[model samples]
Target: MSGQTMYEKIWRSHEIVDLGDGFSLLHVDRHMLHDGSGPVLARLKERGRSVSQPDLCFATLDHVVSTAPGRPVTSDNRRRTIASLRDGVAEAGIRFFDIGRTGQGIVHVIGPELGISLPGTVVVCADSHTCTHGGMGAMGFGIGSTEAEHVLATQTIVQAKLRTMRVTFVGNAGDGVTAKDLILAAVGQLGSAGGNGYAVEYAGRAIQTLEVEARLTLCNLSIELGAKVGMVAPDEKTFDYLAGRQFSPKNELWNRALASWRDLPSDHDAIFDAEIEVDISHLKPKITWGTSPAHVMDIDGIVPDPSSTGHRNAVQYMDVVPGRPLVGLKVDWVFIGSCTNSRISDLRIAANIVGGRKVADHVSAWIVPGSENVKRQAESEGLDRIFKESGFEWREPGCSLCLAANGEAVPPGARAVSTSNRNFVGRQGPGARTHLASPAVAAASAIRGVISDFRTMKD
Candidate 1:
């Protein structure tokens, strides 16, 4: 066969059976479970199923865990969910990262943080953003509850082959432009469904230069682009980031892993089903104005006409007129966390911008780290003090308002500039209007009480 892509390499290596009709049974290397996992495990038990290879499985309480400073379970339903997962994992002999544990946090966040997500491995979780693991050059994707159960029982999943697409973000990303901004620009250019039915490989000078955490942020939104998986080629930066990480290979095994990862990049002669290039040289920090991520524009641009953009309902719900500029749009809430931008780098960038500035009185701002480790690291670096001193709540780590499932949400009809991945209506709460942006933008907006650009803010 001709040269193959990295996706093909990982997939072919893990594929145990070529179940015909375009499907293959692939062995799972790492499986992550979260609060939502409770119900699935319950159903698995109901059918007399049990976990296979418990050592390969990891569980944590996110999604339903409250990220309050005390980190309370918060409600009866959340209490039950926590108990179910807590009890189920113990019975199945799976490792559980319970609340306040070192690994506790969003499954996607802790996977890369703990090194459980390694280069060239197949990682799966019930969360859509599990694709975030691809930053380490792994072939990771989200699975449904049923598929997750299947992996729990058999340690294998049947998947249809996906078409491959390479989205090469060209040019250098300037100051204030982040991985979040770059990926948002792609969603705007390709539309949310752009990568449908395909696995996307992010490449180019820009992607190659990204730090490991930034790559995770970039790959985190692949699902938003309708991609089944998203990955970047592993390189020295990736290797350096993973070296000595908690779960990474050790000593001799480490050298061997490095050798394997170095070979995981797409071959120079490899071909893809689709190739698209985006020039981010002139791009500004992007923000979503409508209900969908595709309805985006730069901080300086006026909103597109609703009829022309086919976002009349979005415009109506967002309460924006066609010709209005995005900057200076009033916002009531500012959230800087999620699987996407909740890494240490993301927090440091935002804290740098918010160091001496106070969040506007009318804007309620919150900064949540992605995992317990991230939370502790930020505290060690005084990031929490910087945020709290500036009138932002430096809260505990969890999904928090990202999913709004733990009873935390932006008030209805309120506007928020958030760093989370999605801005779909009711995503943050019922009738809440959301504008998605990078952590820098979220911080700037929190200070200005409006959709302001961080680039314009002087420290």
Candidate 2:
């Protein structure tokens, strides 16, 4: 057999039919649902069809659900949306994880935490961050609600294969430099549309050394690069991370699964349509100075001159002057949660930075976990105490303030540093100037009341 890249291997494995025009009828091994699934399930019900393979489907309540502890969902419409999801998934016999229930969390975070996303598997979700599961070496991507309905009805999705690219992070990452920084730097170099039409696989020294949670952060931003799918090849680390998770194979089956997963890496001779390399030996923690992620600037660096129309608009909207440093700029809020960086590992990173330090009195900070399990785990480790004692609000699990669609938002015209993936205008709230950084940087900024790099802090 010829050399095969992991994408080629996973793609061919799930292909049910070779459709012309570069598309294929792909059998989906896992389909994850969230409150956004309500409309799709309704469409399926309208067709008088139950899910084809409910056993492979999972649902969770995350988006649209309030993250306020012990407080009921404030919006009647949101409550109704949750109820509809529960009713539909129950009727279809798909596993459902409601608020306050086991496995209830952000769809992307819960999948791997529950072991439903495994190496070499094909995973899809109605949510775009489904590419986050690519950190586990799965062939994962997102679909629209209509496509979601089709997957529910037939357990398959018709997809066009993509050209592939390899983005290698060369050299070592210094202290306080994170996957978030690495990706931000990459986007800064490649621009928002760099990976258009390609499935990008991250590799090399830095990627290989990163923990799985960090890898998830790296892949979570793949969509920002205009790629539908981003992947990392499975290795011993991936296998170990999934070894005993709730839905992982057991006993002899575990061995069999690992053996297969071991073979999922791209061969040395495998060819990619494009290649890009980034060196991070001297890379610093990065933050977005403008709306697009590609507008990243070093945490200690000055705002760049408006070089394009978009840059001019970003500078105007953010109300930041060109050629001025962002460090020590006042910020009104700090958020540390999202599919991109809300895992327990991320929380620990923030906690270590926030311990024995108080959030700047001028800044409001929130620490939201990605899942119920992640919250529980953080509490068990006393990470919650570190955050709360440091004046950060310990929020329940949900995608709060990330998209600001659930009544949680930064105030208009306020400057905020967030750990969420995007910094689009009004992403946090109308006129909110969002600077995207990592959990460590967000935590450090929370204490300093400015966009400060974590590495420069004194003990």
Candidate 3:
């Protein structure tokens, strides 16, 4: 018998019908909508169509809401967007977790936390970071506004299947080297587009050891590697994370669901279209030095020379000498949140680093939780107090300062060491020099007022 991969198994099981020429009418088990999905819902409304399966839809406010404490809807446009989302969800009879509510937060973060994204299922969101749900072993990916409307009209989407790629990480990462650093290293080695057009599965000892939150962090950046779908096989850890959650199955249903999920991993001899192996035995904490995620280096290493086509421009734009080490480079700001890193575990890591320390008087720092749940969880454990005491702004949950979409931005010409993904020009603000790092690094740098190695800080 031929061995089937996890991706193939999920695809075959969820495929309603084959449409030929590599297209299939795929069943979407969970349809997640956010502010960006507002326009699509409006379009569906204009067409006099109602959501075919509103029970499968879940909506939240994330992309454009202010993450400031008290969960303020700062602008009239944002308020209007919120109103449209509420109306659309009400008309469709779908669940809406608005700001300041129990389930509200980044759509990606809250989905898995609430068990809406489960193993052996298909998850779709309008945002590019929708793949973040793949950490729960679901076949999750992003779609466009048009696709959003299609899903809303009918609980299925027409899509071409992607080729499969298996990336294995062998050897243990050193202390302070996290999922963030490992993915950054993979991006550095494979280049940004290496996983293009493939459904990439991360495996091996290192991946197997990551907690569910860390696994989510790794899968969250899969799109940064140019793949829309990135997944990890669900195991005991996945089941543990989902057990007893608000939306998770209860009692007998839980056991039945677990039985089904246990069978979803790929067979031993499953074949993949492409395979890549990476060794993290000697890996160090990494940070992005240029505009692209691929333009990265070790936190303690020297910047790369601008010999590549885009490296010259990236270096010039970043205002850094190529051969200088990233350590000790003065920074003006630090941001430690986003869909990528803002979970309770991420908060603890940063809090541990800055517990009794204060942020550098020269640097401005902020810590925005990924969701309201995360904020409450952190506050319960006094993590917010640690951050605020350390001179970091302990803000409410939203995608704050990550994209500057809510008017929360890094100063122009200021350099920021951030825990968020992406270091693209003006991603945080016009002319902002953004350097991507892990939460620990961001916290330590905020204290030191420079790009720094968090592991070297004295306890």
Candidate 4:
């Protein structure tokens, strides 16, 4: 018999009961909640079920919460939502990372950073990018509000078994090519719905060489790729990143956890339902030209024909001339924050490029850290000052500008080079034209006031 894939291994361990017909009742090891998750807590209570394991759950504020410095939790709806989760968790004895707390930040960012995400465990959240935890080898996926209530009420969820696909990154990435670019290239090759119903595992030398944060960025976009879950088999790098984190196993527990993590990778003889190889040996930084992530293009490439059925609407909405390139296309905004790319390392990459260079006069640019911890660390390293000197706003952390949910929006008809995961119509704001790219590319675009190539900008 062939060996089991990592997803299969984790799924088998978590199966509490086999419901037959490809479905199982799976134990949930960790639960993460955000501001929008208040409804789930209310629903769980409404059903007269108490939180089954409050100690295993955590709550924080992210979506729809303002990212402004000293931002007030105003508005009846926002205040009520925040209060509901805060009060519910407090009542249930769950951990709450409230505002001004060290662990507070975006849900996906805080999960891995705090070590709530671990290999060989099942982590679920109401946010689609909860798959970000899979960077550490966990079986992570998003759940709907109903599913969230079910997990909280019983510490288990009913789920369908997913077919596994292995995406192998062949050869090394070229300079200026980031994990963001690599995934964008894959989306371009495989199309948006390529991985529908499949649990995708990223492998090969390129994935093996990426650090944990880059892996998080890679898995964060799995939902956009139409995959329910995405993961990298844990290795020494995963153990190294998790060690000493707030909730990570410690001392003797740490040693045992490390031993188990070493066993999480797929065996050499493992078989996948499908296999794909993305040749990134000569890849360049990429940007999204249309609404979907699959509508990607090279830094020096021309736009697709607007006359094409797939592109006509996006092209007309973005107001771009078909056959023309995006370089030197004036940008009105540059956002360098998102669960996708707002970690400390991502900030360093952007600060390195923006240092000693001023943002264009017409470009409104901002840099938001992923969490309070990341914000503090960046300030300690003076990255905030570097950004400020370069005319970039060093703002508080949240899901800012990425979804435009926290009272932030890119003006209608304005062009933005963003580091967020999605470039869908209205994803940023009403009629906002978003070009999704990496932190390096966003920094370069802020300076050039257009969709310029970071490779062309010398430090």
Q: TM-scores, in order shown?
A: 0.98, 0.98, 0.98, 0.98
lDDT of each: 0.91, 0.91, 0.91, 0.91
Model 4 Cα lDDT, one tens digit per residue, 340-448: 9999999999999999999999999999899999999999999999999999999888998999877699999999999999998988999999999999999999998
Hey, what RMSD does candidate 4 come out at? 1.0
Q: Give candidates' CA RMSD values in order.
A: 1.1, 1.0, 1.0, 1.0
RMSD of 1: 1.1
lDDT of 1 by residue, 1-459 (tens): 678999999999999999999899999999999989988888999999899889999999888788888876668998998898998898899999988889998888999888899999999999899899999999999999999999999999999999999999988877778899999999999989999999999999989888999999999999999996999999999888888988899999999999988899999999999999999989998888899988899977899987654598899989988898989989999999999999999999999999988999999999989999999999999999999999999888889888799989989999999999989989999999999999989999999898998888775
lDDT of 2 by residue, 1-459 (tens): 668889999999999999999999999999999998987898899989878999999999888888888847778888788888988998899999888897999999999999999999999999888889999999889899999999999999999899999999999987779999999888888889998888989999889989998899999999888887999987888888998999999999999998898889999999999999999999988998999999998888999999889889999999888989998889899999999999999999999999999999999999989999999999999999999999999998999899986788999999999999899989998889999999988998999998887888995
lDDT of 4: 0.91
Candidate 4 colliding pairs:
none
lDDT per residue as tens, model 3, 1-459 = 779999999999999999999999999999999987777888998999879999899999887888776767788988888788888888779999988899999888999999999998999998878888889999999999999999999999998999999989989899999999988888888888998998989999999999999999999999889989999999999999999999999999999999999999999999999999888999999999999999999999999888787999999889988889989999999999999999999999999999999899999999999998999999999988999988989887888898998878998999999988889999999999999999988999999998999889985
Candidate 1 similarity to native, TM-score: 0.98
- Angstrom error at residue 345, model 1: 0.5
Candidate 3, clashing residue pairs? none
Backbone clash total, candidate 4: 0
* Total clashes in model 1, counting residue pairs 3 or more apart in sequence or in different chains: 0
lDDT of 1: 0.91
